[model samples]
Target: MMLGLKTLLLFGLGGQELLLIALIVLLLFGGAKIPELMRGMGKGVKSFKEGMKEVDEVKKDIENEVKKDEE
Candidate 1:
């Protein structure tokens, strides 16, 4: 099963595809920027999570305020 998968992957990329991707990344970001790029991605995900949590908090607060106002 695994051998079949590896064969498919090898056929897909072969040597030339791998070389092309490597050259593109090297030209675009050079060596030093890869980690920075990944770090920024991590921070973006974190900020998204925090923003979602804040939204959830505000929603709950609004619900409570409405309940209190009704009472």
Candidate 2:
């Protein structure tokens, strides 16, 4: 299981491979646009996290209500 997890995380990528990928992204997006792209991605991730937290809170509330009814 650990080995599988490691393989999934790295996908066997080495330093050179990662550097090449970064270069490709820089070339495709150019120097000026990368920061904007990253900022949008960061915002998207933050929104996703907040949505997940709200879902978890609602789930806990429902569970608590169920417990109250049982009592």
**The best candidate in terms of TM-score:** 2
lDDT of 1: 0.85
Determine the backbone clash count of candidate 2.
0
Once fitted onto the true fold, the runs of candidate 2 whose alpha carbons sit more than 4 angstroms away are 1-9
lDDT of 2 by residue, 1-71 (tens): 46644774577776687688889999999999999998998899789989999999999999999999999
* Model 2 residue 35 CA deviation in Å: 0.4
C-alpha lDDT of all candidate models, in order: 0.85, 0.87
Q: What TM-score, over all chains together, does every model reach?
A: 0.58, 0.80
- Model 2 is weakest, by summed lDDT over 10 consecutive residues, at 1-10
Q: Compared with the true structure, what per-residue lDDT tens digits does model 1 show for residues 4-71?
A: 45875777866677678778988999889978987998899789989999999999999999999999
- The local lDDT score (0 to 100) that residue 2 gets in candidate 2 is 61
Where does candidate 1 clash, by residue pair?
A: none
